[model samples]
Target: MNPLAHLRPALDAGLVELGLAAPALSARLLDYLALLDRWNRAYNLTAIRDPREMVVKHLLDSLAMAPFVGDETLADLGTGPGLPGIPLALARPGLRVTLVESNGKKARFLREAVRRLGLANARVAGCRAEALDEPGAYDCLTARALGTLAELVRVGGHLLKPGGRLLAMKGLAPADEIAALPPDWHASAVHALRVPGLDAERHLVVVTRRAA
Candidate 1:
């Protein structure tokens, strides 16, 4: 039995549920999953071994935030295996994505994935998130399973332009982390995401900087 045969239907269903009903985009997403699956065997890029689970957890979970992404430059901090960044880039061809990763192997995998997927709007940055010093370089930033809201803003805040947004994906509605946000920043909205076929509680924390 072919894995994509099983995975395709689920992926298609999930994408439609997420309001991404484009057949062409769905096909490209599956291509990314196939590439990730093939590399995982050798590089262990992701801990999720099952392809079906990847469809739900990685693909759908990431795409769940597509509705909230703005059409501008986005920097994905600690983008291991290019989560929301890669998928978002595929969905929005006009959006430029910069995937920042420190690990050599994962960074290599990201570069290869971008090349093989022919994502001309995407690029890989082989460095740590905190080391990025491009103040106001991006209009939006994303971090998936990366860190607390405070920590993410503390390190990646400089990368965002004034009035820019940070979309942080987390398992739960981290109240404590939200409470701990820097005084200069505030939670604009916290959206609870519903990833198709995923029973886990997923939330997208939308944070923005306060004017000086």
Candidate 2:
């Protein structure tokens, strides 16, 4: 019952086409999914338990923005089950990812997963964004299924460097939220992305800091 047999082609094609990691990264992703599904039972990490859906909804959906991640450090805001953050980090090993969650149970799960998965670059922070001391220090920040664009920007603004960007993973286009962006920090570019193995509804909202 090797999941990779069914997943390899679609996963490879998706990552390669999306410009995520090389096709080889898919194997690691598959391995990671196995662990996720096992932990999910006790941890209640994610709702979707099916491997296929996990690949499409979680893994591929996260990699849609691999190109934009570039060399900057990334933080996952309000990360509950590590959808876009953990998957994104698994896909792009070179990227630095901080998974922020206020829940003690989820944070403990993430820490255990990071250690067991040998994810040296992935870290778990059990705190609200405002409580952290570092401000305007991150190269990139991300919020997946966290909150409205305005709210995320307001709370997570201090996490981004002066010229860094914020990547928001959303289920639909955020027109009203985009409109409400602060003029100085509004999006400089908005890219409508496609995740190869995921649902068409997936979108990556990129907002870079605009100069005043």
Instruction: Give the TM-scores of the predictions, in the order they appear.
Output: 0.96, 0.89
Candidate 1 residue-wise lDDT, 1-212, digit = tens: 33466577788899889999898888888888888998899999999999989999998998998998767999999999999899999998888999999999999999999998899999999999889867899999999978889999988999998789999999889999989999989899999999999988999999998878
Question: In lDDT terms, which candidate is top?
Answer: 1
Superposition TM-score, candidate 1 onto the true structure: 0.96
lDDT of each: 0.91, 0.78
What value does the lDDT take at residue 193 in candidate 1? 90
Candidate 1 weakest ten by summed lDDT: 1-10
- 19 Cα displacement, candidate 1 (Å): 0.7
lDDT score, candidate 1, position 32: 89
Question: Candidate 2 — number of clashing residue pairs?
Answer: 1
**Which ten-residue region of model 2 has the weakest summed lDDT?**
1-10
Model 2 agreement with the true structure over 94-206: per-residue lDDT tens digits: 88898998988888878877887788888988998767667877898888777888888888888888888888977778888899988766766667778775556756787
Model 2 deviation from the true structure expressed as Cα RMSD, one decimal place: 2.2
